[model samples]
Target chain A: MNDDDILEQAARWRSEGKGVALATVVSTWGSSPRPAGSHLAVDQDGAMIGSVSGGCIEGAVVLEAQEAIKSGNPRLLEFGVSDEDAWAVGLACGGRVQVYVEPIE
Target chain B: MKGALLDRLLAERAAKRPAALVTSLNGGGQSLVTAEETHGDLALPLNVVAAARTALRSDRSGIVEADHSRFFIRVYNPPLRIAVVGAVHIAQALAPMAALAGYEVTVIDPRQAFATESRFPGVRLVTEWPDEALGALRPDRRTAVVTLTHDPKLDDPALEVALRSDAFYIGALGSTRTQAKRLHRLQELGFNQEQLGRIHGPIGLKLGGRAPAEIAIAILAEATQVLHQGEAAEAEAAGAL
Candidate 1:
């Protein structure tokens, strides 16, 4: 889905009384899978749509997004190839990506 | 991001208006900036709004720093459109290719027999006269208009409308001699040399292919080249300015 579709889904989730968090790739250092404005929308029930770092960090980001939805606070998470577990999840492309996760209010 | 602002953003997109959504990372504020007006209460600075408009024109989304605040400007332009003004064999090949390349393809031909749905599946077909269809479509900078019909009554009228519009690429399929004759006729109609120069007569990259599909490939390739390189040239011009 495009950014608009993700945002629209977030709006729908909010109206439906379900907690929602929007994760956006705010910046990338190198060889990022998606561009800076890519988004991922996660609901309170773990239902998710869209993508941020292709498949490398989506699970981690989704977990963090659920936490943000609960705490009602935004979180900025960063992932890079130099991380210890980078190779385990296939992010060893010598790149770093910063994602911002914020709850929809 | 969940009230009037989101509503307006969706409305603008639905109406096919060019817009940008600016989100401030530090403050978590959002603003919708359109060519006609700015919506929402993000309290964005003038410089940020200016930068957002520039991003809209470039049809790209990225982060911009203004006054120590980093804002993501998400551009929302209408989909790229390509109107092929002849539902011939070439149009049959080009329409599907253009659609596959993520362009909204429209095949226009007044002849009902040629503009059938079976020939061009899942493509918008217009059976009106070329000029009438083009006028209604109003090809803009995001549009590329190509005239494939060799008939003067059909191709010339469409070319006239395309030249006057802001379409990024205007191409006509013809030989050198045919193009010269067409240019002479257009010149007599009072089009300046520079204006006529916008038409890529003998259209498409010279791939030396005679098959209809091969010709279509060349045309689409040339159109893509012009669309991207033309934007680069305009960006250079703007930077120089």
Candidate 2:
């Protein structure tokens, strides 16, 4: 989905009284799969609408987003390929990404 | 973004208006910026606004820094539109190819027989006069206007509209002598040399192909070159600034 679609979904979720959070790729250091400004919208139930790091790190980001929605606080999450378990988390492309997750409030 | 601001942004996107969504990564503020105005309480620094405007103009989304803060500018631009001012055989071939390349193609011709849905399936067909059709289309910076009609009556009016608008690429399919005559006519109509220079007369790169499909391919290739190079030129200008 495009950014507009994800944002629209977030708006719908908010209007429906469900908690929502948005995760956006703010920066990339190496061969990141997606570019900056890529977005992923998550509801309280962990349903997502878009992607931040393609398949890599989305699961982690979604988990963080759900937590942010519950806590009403934003979090900045970073994932780098140099991490010991990078491949296990799907960052095998040798890139680093910074994602900012914030609640819809 | 929520409520009215998000609704307004979605409406802008639906209207095909070029805009930018500026998000403050540190402060968690968001705003929508268009050519006309900025909406929402996105108290961005001046430098960040400048950078966001640049990104919006180039139809690119990225991050920028200003006043010790980082902001992401997400650009929203309408799809590239191509107005081919002839429903000739070449239009039949070009429309689908251009659509495959992600351009919204419109084939215009006053001749209803040639501009039928049977001839060009899944392409926007405008059967009005060239001038009227082009005027209503309002070709902008992301639009490419190509005149495939050899008839001076049909082609000239379309050329006039394309020349006056912000269309990025203006091409006319014709031979050398035909192009010369067209140029002379346009000059007589008060178009300056620089304005007339925008026309890629005898349009399309010479690909040594005589078939209609080959000609369509050549036009698409030339149009793509102009479109991408125009973006590069804008990027260079922004970097220099």
Candidate 3:
């Protein structure tokens, strides 16, 4: 779904009493998979919708989003191909992106 | 992101009102900026709010750094819209193609036979007179209005409304001679030269294509060009001001 539809879905999940977090690609550089403003919605059960990147970094983002939901604290996550975690969760493409994850309180 | 703020943002978007969500990375403090107001946990500085307005105008989302903090401004502008004022064969090709390109396509034609559901499956069909239809549609900066009817009664009224509005792109299908004649008529109707110039007559990029679908592609290409270039021009104008 597009980010707007995902936002609507996030609202639905929020109304349903599912603790939800919103992760948005706030900025990108080089061959980033998605543009800034791309969104990924994560719920308490780890269910997710939309995407902040290609399938590569979603698992890591979901973990952070779940943490934000639990702690009621937001996180600014930066990932790039040059990072030590590149092999595990960084974008496979040679690009960098900053994601902001916050609970949908 | 309070639930009430989220709802207000959604409501503003639903109403096609331009807005932005600004968040400071350091504190996670956020604010919503609209044309008239700003509200949220943070009271952003004037420069940051100005940056958000610029982002809204250009329809770009990005990072804005000010006052030793990093802020992300996520702009929420209305979806690009195309109001094709004729359900002719070209529009039969243009409507779905524009939709695929992420435009909200509306085919306006009063002729029921030409504007039937079968002709425009999965596209919005407005079987009202061109002028009335466009009047209600209220074309905005993100809207592109194209008159393909090639009839003065229909195209003229639509052109009048379009030329009076801030529609980013206004195209009318015709040859050079026809365009000249159309311009004369609009000029007689009180539109100044600059306003008349906004109409991209002989519509579409001169791709030298003749088929309906090929012509549609040319029109879409020209419209897309105007959409982006117009945004740049507007930004330059705002900067000048």
Top DockQ hit? 3
Q: Provide all candidates' interface root-mean-square deviations.
A: 2.7, 2.9, 1.4
Each prediction's Cα RMSD? 3.3, 3.9, 2.8
Clashes of 1: 0
Per-residue lDDT, model 3, residue A88, is 76
Model 1 earns a TM-score of 0.83
**Docking quality (DockQ) for each candidate:** 0.43, 0.41, 0.63
Which of the two, 1 or 3, has more DockQ? Answer: 3
The CA root-mean-square deviation of candidate 2, after full C-alpha superposition on the true structure, stands at 3.9
The DockQ value obtained for model 2 is: 0.41
* Candidate 1 residue lDDT tens string, A21-99: 8888878888988877788999998899989976888888888999998898887778887877666666766799888
> Per-residue lDDT tens digits of candidate 1, residues B4-50?
67677778877878888888888877889999788776888998888
TM-score of chain B of 3: 0.91
Write the candidate numbers in order of decreasing TM-score: 3, 1, 2
Comparison by TM-score, 1 against 2, better one: 1
Clashes of each: 0, 0, 0
Off by over 4 Å in 1: A1-20, A40-60, A83-88, B175-181, B205-217, B234-241
Docking class of 2: acceptable
Q: Which scores greater on TM-score, model 2 or model 3?
A: 3
Clashes of 3: 0
Reference-based TM-score of each model: 0.83, 0.78, 0.88
